[model samples]
Target: MSYEDAFAAMAAGTDEAVANALELFPSEIQTISIDGADHLLITPQNLDPGLANHLLIHVHGGAHVFFSPETALNSSLAAAHAVGARILSVRYPLAWKAKFPASRDRVVAVYRHLLQDYPANQLAFYGGSAGGGLILSSLQHLLAEGTDMPAAALLLSPWVDVSGTGDSYAVMSGHDPVIDYPVSLASAAREYAGTLPLTNPGPSPIYGPIESGLPRILLTSGTRDLFLSDVARLQRRLIDAKIPVELIIYEGMWHVFQTSTGLPESSTAWRDFARFLRTAWAID
Candidate 1:
C-alpha cells in the first residue's frame, strides 16, 4: 500500500493502529514514565546495571502521526544492541492530536530531566525519518535555551525539510519504496506545522541557521531515499557552520533501510552508527 493509504487507515482508527504497531515491540522492553511523558527503556539482555554511563535517546519516526515510543522500540533496540548502550526512547505527543511544538517541547523536557542524572557529554541522540528532524529541531531548541548539548546525534534518512521542497521528492518517486510524495510527508508536515510555517526552524530545521555549540551530527541516507535532499542540505549547512558531521549514503537503498536486519548493507550502517557513538565518547 502507498504511504497515503496506510496513513488513511491509521487515521481511521488510531487506537487499533497503535495497538497493531505495538506488536513489533519487544516483550522484554520496559515502559516507564519520565517527567510525566511516556518512555521506553530498552537494554541488552545481558547488560550490566553498572555499565549504564552511556545512554542513547532514541526518537522514533512515524511521520509525526503513527508510532509511539512503545511501537517503535524495535528500531531503538537494534540501535542499543549495535552500540552496546542503553536506549531511552521518548514518547512524545503526535501531530494529529497536539500539533508541532508540543512534541518538540516534550523532547526538550525529557532531555533536561535526563541531564539531572546523566551528563550531557555521556548522552547521544538518535532518530530516523521524522524523528531525525526532531533531533535537529530539538538541538536548535536546546541551543536557544542555553542548555548544554549532547555529545552527538545520529540521524537516519532525516526528514529535515517539512517544506517538501527537496528535489528528491520529485525525482525519486517510484524509486523510493516507502515514501509517497506530497501526500506522505507534505500532508503530515502540514498537520505538524499547524500555525507555524513549514520553514520555521522549530519545524523544518534545515531552514535554520546552524550556529556553534551544536552537537556533532552523523547523518545517513540512501541514494534512493526521498529524503536524500533533506540530509544533504542539512549536512552542507552544518559544514558551513563548522559543526562536525559524518554523512553516509548507502547506494541503491531506500529510506531508513538500515532497519532491515541481516543485510550486509544494514550491518555496515549499524556498525557505522556504533563506531560514531564510540568515537564521540572516546570509547575504545
Candidate 2:
C-alpha cells in the first residue's frame, strides 16, 4: 500500500483505529492516575518480571490537539513489552484547554514525579510528533532548573520546530498525506503558546540550545514527512553541541508511521526503539 493510503487508514480515530492497528501486538493495559490526572499504563504481559525495574515514560502524539493516553495505550504497551520494561503514558493537558507553560509544565511535573520512583539513569523518555516536541521542551525546562534528565530519549517523527522553519515544510507539503498543512500546525502551536514566543526554547526546542549532559537521543523520521527538515536540523544542532544522537530516516514514510503497528515500517521502528531502549538503559 502507498503512504497516502496507509495514513488515511491510520487517521480514522484514536480509540478504535489505534486499537485495531495495534491488535497484532499484545500488551497488558491498565488505567491509572498521575498527579490527579488519569493515565494508562501499558506493558507487555510476557515482559520478564525481573526487568520491571526499568521504566519508559511515554507521551502520546496528537499535534497537541487530539488523542489521549488511552489512544496510545497499545503502542506504549508493545514498546514496553518489546524491551521488557514498564511504561507510563501521561494524559497531559491539551492545547485547547491549557496553553504553553501549562502543558509543558504538566509534563515536566510528571517527569519529576517519575524520578521520585525510578532513578533518572534507569528511565527513558519516549514520544512522537507533538509528544516528541514535548519531550524536548520538558528536558530544556528541567535542565534550566538543574533537574535531572532521563538516561535517553526516543522521538519518532518529532515536530521540533514550532516556528515551522524546516525546508521540508514546503518540500514535502504535498507528499505528506497525514498532516493537513503547515498552517494548521502553526495555528495549534500559536494557540498552545498563547503569548509565548513561538521560537522559545521551551516552546520550539529546535531553536533552543542543547543542554550539556542531557540524555542521548534516538530520533526517527521519514523522508516524506513534513517535519523531515526539522528532525534533520535538530540532529545537526545536537551533534554540534557534542550531544549523543542517533537518527534513522525511513524512505517514503510519513509522520509517526510506527503508530500503525500493522505496517511493516511500524514493526521495524518499534524493534529499533526497543533495542535502543535496552542499550541506552544498559539493560542486561
Candidate 3:
C-alpha cells in the first residue's frame, strides 16, 4: 500500500477505537461550523463555577495525519467531563492533507473567532499528543501577533519537538509500545512538516523561544511515553521563560494514554486535572 493508503488504513482502524471510546464519556455533543470549519461543541452534565460561562478550546491529535472529525470529540472527552464546561473542539485539517502551517493556522483562526464571542480570561486550551504541540506553536503565533492569551492550557503527552532530538526518542525506542520512532512518528513528523524543516519551531515549539504572553499551563505525560522528553524539556523551557507551568509524569503509561477511559491511570489523571483547572480559575 502507498503511504497515504497506510495512513488511511490506520485512521480507519483508529476511528472505530475512538468511536468506542466516545461512548464511555456521556456528553451532549453538537457540531457547528466556525468560519466554514467543523467544530464539535460538547457539554457534559457536571458543572463547575470555574467553567461557568467559560469555554475550553480543544485541539485534537493524530500526528497531524490520522483521526477523523468524530474522533476529535473522543480525544477531548476527558476535558469535557472534568472541566464540566462547553468545549469547542476545532477540527483542524490533517497535516497529510493540509501541510505544516495549514493545520496550525486553522486552529489559530478558530481561536480568533472564539475570542470575539468570549473574553480571553474565560477561554483556555486543552489538547493532547500532536494537539498539545499544536497548541503551543499556535500560541507562539498569537504572541507574535500581539493577541491576548487565554487563562490556562492543559496538555496531555504533547509531542512538542517533532525533530526527534529528545532523550526519550532514543531511550524509549525499545520501550514505548504506543509509538515506534523510526517506523511511526519519524515519518509522520516529516509528513506533517511537509516542505518545512522539522525544527522550524512553528511545528516544533521546543526549538522556539518560549517567551512571555503565554497563559498558565499544565502538561502531563507517562514515564513510558515517547513524548516524555518533549514534555519535560518544554516544562523547563517554559519555566526558564518565567511561565507558570506544571508538569505531571504518570508511572508506566504511554503516549496519550489518558484517552483510554477504562484505565485506572486515566481516572486519576482526570481527577488531578480537575483540581488544576479549579485552581487555575480560582474556583476554590
Candidate 4:
C-alpha cells in the first residue's frame, strides 16, 4: 500500500492492529514512575542473559499530546532485537498537564538516572516525530549544562520546528495522510509550549545551536513528510558543525510511515534503523 493509504489505515486505530501484529515477538510491557509520573517501559522477554552494555531510550510521539510507549511496541521490539540492546520507552509528561520543559525535563531525569548505572558512551537516544524533537531538545539541555551526551541518536521524521516555518509544511500538507498539518499540530504545540517561545532551542531544536562533541546522529524522514524541511535544516546545521550525521530520506513516504509495522515500507525503515543501532553500539 502507499504511505498515504497505510497512514489512513493506521489513523483508524492501527495501534490495536499493530499490537496484535507484534504478538509473535517475545517482549514485556510495563510502567515505571519517572518524576512521580507513570512511564511505560518495553523490553524483550528473554533479552540475552548478559547485561547489555548498550541501552536505547525511546520517547514516544503524539504531537506532545497523545499516545504513549504502549502505542510504539511493535517498532520498539524490532529495534531491540536488531540492535542487541535493551529498550527503555519513557512515558514523559504530556502537554495537557505539564508543558514544554516539563516533558523535556522528565526525560532528562530518566537519562540522568540511567547514567548512574550505565556508561554514558553506551546509551543512545531514539525517537520519531515529536519524540524526535524531544530527543534533540533534551540533548541541547544536557549540553548547555555541561552534561555528557548520548553515544548516538536516531531521529525518525522529527518535528524539530514548532514555529512551522519549514518550506515542506505546505508542500507535504494534504499529501501526508497521518498529520493534518498546521491546524492540529500547531495548536497542540502551542498548548505544549505554553508561554515559552516556540523558537527556543529547548522547545524546538532546529533553532538551537549545534553543539560540538554530540554523539553520532542518524536522521530518517520521508520526502513527503511535512517536517521534511525541518529535517533538512537540521542536517545542514549538523553537517556544517562537522558532526557525524547520516540522513535517510525515503521517497514518496509520509510522516512516521514506519509506525505501520505491517507495511513493506515500515519493514525497510526498521531494518535501516536496526543497522544504524548495531553499528552505533558496536554490536557484532
* Model 1: worst 10 consecutive residues (lDDT sum): 18-27
lDDT, candidate 3, 1-284, per-residue tens:
65679766867777766676567667778888887787888887675655668888888887878765576655676677876777888888887677889988998999899898898988888888899999999998998999999889899988898888888888888798778778788888998898889998888988987998799999999989988889889999899999999899999999888877678998889888878876776774
Q: Please list all clashing residue pairs in model 1, or write none if there are none.
A: none
Per-model TM-score, in order, reads 0.90, 0.91, 0.94, 0.90
List residue ranges in candidate 2 displaced over 4 A: 1-12
Deviation from native of the Cα of residue 59 in model 2, angstroms: 0.8
Error of 3 at 36 (Å): 2.0
Q: Please give the TM-score that candidate 4 achieves against the real structure.
A: 0.90
Best by TM-score: 3
lDDT tens digits, residue span 123-187, model 4: 99999999999999899888888888887899998889888887898887898888866666887
Error of 2 at 96 (Å): 0.6
Task: Compare candidates 1 and 3 on TM-score and give the better one.
Answer: 3
Clashes of 4: 0
RMSD of each: 3.7, 4.5, 1.7, 4.6
- Against the reference, the lDDT scores of all candidates come to 0.83, 0.80, 0.83, 0.80
Q: What would you estimate as the lDDT of candidate 2?
A: 0.80
Error of 3 at 6 (Å): 3.7
Q: Give one digit per residue, the lDDT tens place, for model 1 in 213-239.
A: 999999999999999999888888899
